[model samples]
Target chain A: MRKNGVNMIKISAKNVDVFYGKKQALFNINLDIEENQVTALIGPSGCGKSTFLRCLNRMNDVIDICKVQGEIVINDFNINDKGCDVVRLREKIGMVFQKPNPFPKTLYENISYGPTIHGMAQSKQEMDEIVETSLKKAALWEEVKDRLHEPGTGLSGGQQQRLCIARAISVQPEVILMDEPCSALDPIATAQIEELIDELKKEHTIIIVTHSMAQAARVSQRTGFFHLGELIEHGSTDKIFKNPDNIKTQDYITGRFG
Target chain B: MSEAPHTVKSYEEELKNLNSNIIKMGGFCEEALGKAVQAITMRNSDHAESVIKDDEKIDKFETLIEQQVVNLIALRQPMAIDLRETVTALKISSDLERIGDLAKNISKRTLLLNENLPKNLVDALVRVSSDVQKQLKSILDAYLDRSSSVAMNVWESDEKTDDLTNLCMQEVIKYLKENEKNLDDGTHLLFVTKNIERIGDHTTNVAEQVYYLVTGKYLEGDRPKGTEPIVTGEK
Candidate 1:
């Protein structure tokens, strides 16, 4: 539902915190992400941005010592609830990582794996269509359509990242969490991925965590700045880059301090 | 927010250089206006020639400031207050350069005047010039202090200069129609009055930039303007 204005709130986190044994990684963070818009999370290293991102789809649960607190609500249900099916919740939320990682299987297999496991296709022809459409959506179709049988890891770093992105979209997820997706690529490859992100936001709600303030300013409609395990500021990207309210945010973005 | 130095010392030095260059150019503009006024009121062609000759320094400062601004944007990729600071430096320098050019134009017209003028006409012109100089000085102070309130004060004071300019224009027109011999000096006086009025306008533009640099929002609504001289529609 719409909370502040015209944009619908896709995900709302209220007083969310994360702890790894004795150390608290994140303090109370309250942020509402809008649908079909890119939300960027930026801060210095070890600021809990990645931890906060992992909490969205219970990715943090895989860590034996990590404990998460508070409500992460999407559409009227809390994804953090004990009754929530993590596998089902993960199916609705896809993730891309900092490094370009593609499975050891063939390129075609990489795109089909998620759908095959999720039972999204009923026949061979349906699976092939899903593979083709996912590759095209990832903007890697023309480069790899003729070599779908080749190992996914055999591709270039940029192409492999796109392949991973293709794999993520194969399940038709509603939200995409990218953690420094372009950090390992060259400038040209980074630009291509940034363009893909702009196009992807038309169909998916995107939340990106990056140390590059320029990237956050370029791609995000909204930006949140985290510092010392606390969310220091969050607002429109323009406002954050132009005139952020908090002193810590201004200093961080302007390179005065971390 | 606490004023902290940038992590990279070089970037901080570059920004400091830009600010100093702007202040230097502002000083030159103020000096040019002062000299131009002295030339006109005291009938000193030497002072007028010096003001015109020194216009090139102001122009060079504009070029230097613009180059630094471009380099900052390309290399530093400044954000937030730094971005606004760079942009306003470019804008304020351009306005200051225009002020220098206007002051030079007034000095150029001074060289063309040979006939003696009445004391009241010269006094009115001096009043306009003095008000514009005060406005320019206040804007420069506001810029250095990063004070929006000071800039707002300068912005609201433009009407005073405009009123004085209008009065000077009327005096020149009356002097011209009073006698055929007074036409040449009176015509030159009219141009000088216009140049001084334009300098006042450029100062107001600098005031607006200072306001925007200090606070990200533009000064809201229409700028307060003074009444214009009435025009005769038809014979």
Candidate 2:
């Protein structure tokens, strides 16, 4: 892990590559995901945006056939290092997925689960405070406050996605990786989630992988355009949309092709 | 994508060429006005003839600069200040060319007045011609230098030319009223006065362009009393 309070990158990828067993899924990737700003990774489907995102906190480690090469330095530690603590690393970097995967437990316990696993709470009072604060940060506290004991599965899909966000926030991660976090939500819920992302950027560095160009244009300060597992161009969002230097980037933004 | 550097350099070159061509055309028109007025006052038919010939060159330069401006707009896709400068150049060139045309008109009047005339009336026209020539030169200088102070001077002096033209018109009317035998001479004198008045108008047009070139804004109608000074910058 990075030394406390020192100048360390939030996340840095150098010459990174990913493979699902034999077939390579990503080319040599180099990027710096900065602190407290949104960096959007945009590309067509199956272009390795999600695969690259999963490498940050070792989410790809679950797939036995997948192998990742190169360093992903978060703080001072590479999560791919042999002796690195995967659980502690994951606790510092949380993720919300494409679909809201809320647990079958009570809404209160869903948030408390991470802190309990990490031994962060000393007693019931501390655990209850963590749950309430996380829900508040996720902007779901008012609706769920009266039914803290209700099952998380009973909430609507939008609320469940927010519950997953609340669960992720409960761990107090330094960085948040969102892989199409609002893909299943309606327009209103998507807007709420986008606003939530905007607010979260003030505290945590965010890296989002999205397929929607307009969404990337709306939410990101910097946009990286990927094509066929390669980063074709990357620059300020305004330039990428209005006067892109690369033809591929211009084509993608202008709807000539993906 | 890879040609960005080349495109930028080429656009810069085109802009430079456009500016230089405008300055060159302005110089040619200024020269034509000087010779045209000199021919009228000195009664030198050769100088008057040369001024008429120079008008053709001025027209050619105006046409060339206008084509360049149009091509720059269509090809370079200029925006912001570049757009403003290109449009301003287009307007300025046309105004300069019209000033050339007025100079040609004065040359034509000079040729007509060089015919047999009363010496005193000829002397009066000579004085008026010199004064109008000075105003034209100062106005052109103000435009070239983008000097609003000089432009203001040109604006103030326009009234003097108007007063002289009115006096000349009155003199011509008196000649017509008193001597019914000299009706044709009086009519030509009236034409000479009208030509001088038109030259004054062209001088004012140049002053207006000076104001616009310096401030990138139009000045029209009555002058604003105690208005805030316009801040000058490249548009």
Candidate 3:
């Protein structure tokens, strides 16, 4: 909802461009993200949706050939700045990937790892509280509370994904990025994650990249459709799926063309 | 544009099947409307009975078309224009089905007047019949050719059928005034005229659907209503 008909901006990107050495991946793209809203990025394979998502948190910096140029403001910070502390920057923004990758430790340790590394908990009791709260927020507390000492890797595919989400929330990040976080899970698990996403948006800004249009339609307030490395259209999820302004967006969503 | 010919041919075939089924149903509706009118004009009770019975075929089309669309949505997960197209087909089929009901209603009135159709009522029924029949045909043309102009033409001209119906009702009343013994025929003719007018209304609705299917935008405004002209001084 808009106050006084003006949306509050949580993340803003301007003229964002990405290149793999000489081969350009993303064209100049501008997107305005509203506070406490789930923004979904959707496109065909290799349309650079994931690449553009990585630019938000500077995940592309790890790739030797990938280079991103843009102004991305997370609240008041120019995260692309050279002097910006990469370690602290990552703490403020947490990410869940296409597959669930949990730490090779107990479920309790998986949720406590981030807070412990960041010095968020001063005592063992504080650490335990963080673990429990994060797991509850991820909606995995009841399912795995009995198995807190069990290895995170020993959980079901859905349970493991929720563990990763809890781990992301453990540090109390301001924003969460999910890169097709439910792609490897079953329908029941995908539905659980979608439900968890709706709940998390109350406290954290969420941006998700998913090939499932239905998933994007389910979770996002604002949706951006990318094609051929360009932002084809960006609008409310209803308009994007019901009556998109761009023909390319319509074609891709309608399964008419890639 | 041309949808660039979908990657999956079977999806295309499924969509084609839906369109063909709708067109076939439209043909059935048109035939019923025309036969109902012919039955009254020619004083043929058999033709009137056939028109009433044929409505079952249209109801079947409604069931079949609705099921196909539901399955297509579930199995194919159509989106954007394909989504709009499937929904529009459902809407049109529904209108056509209702129009079939109106045609059946008209034939029932025809059965009541099979032995006593007033000369003026026959002429008026013929007039309303041709007017609404032409509108239905032209709207179908718009649907098949994806022509909004034709659809708009049908939309704009709906008032003429309403005017003809009003005039037919007036004639029926005048016939009753001349012969008090023919009160039953006048009452049935009054109903028949209204039925024909409603047929025009449903045809107009189909025209609006055509406009949406072609342009992907609803005709933005209140529809042109065919108001019933007030009748007075009845004994």
The candidate that wins on lDDT is 1
| Candidate achieving higher lDDT, 1 or 3 | 1
Report lDDT (Cα) of residue A153, candidate 1: 93
lDDT at B81, model 2:
35
**Angstrom error at residue B3, model 1:** 0.8
TM-score of chain B of each: 0.95, 0.77, 0.93
* RMSD versus native structure for model 1: 1.8
Q: Estimate, for each residue in A109-224, the C-alpha lDDT of model 1 and write its tens digit.
A: 99999999899999999999999999999999999999999999999999999998999999999999999999999888888899999999989999999989999998999999
Task: Tell me each candidate's RMSD, in Å, in order.
Answer: 1.8, 14.1, 2.3
Sorted on TM-score, best first, the list reads 1, 3, 2
**lDDT of residue B144 for candidate 1:** 83
Tens-digit lDDT track of model 1 for B86-200:
9999998899899989889989999998747788989989888889888889898888888899999999988888788888888888888889988788778888899898888
TM-score of chain A of each: 0.98, 0.94, 0.97
In order of lDDT, best first, we have 1, 3, 2
Which docking category, incorrect, acceptable, medium or high, applies to candidate 3?
Answer: medium
lDDT of 3 by residue, B1-235 (tens): 2457667889878888898888899999989998998888888888889989999999999999999899988998877767777888899999999999988988888787747566767898789889999999999878888898999999989878877887787788888788888788888888888888888988999999888777777888876656568485252
Off by over 4 Å in 3: B44-46, B114-119, B226-228, B233-235
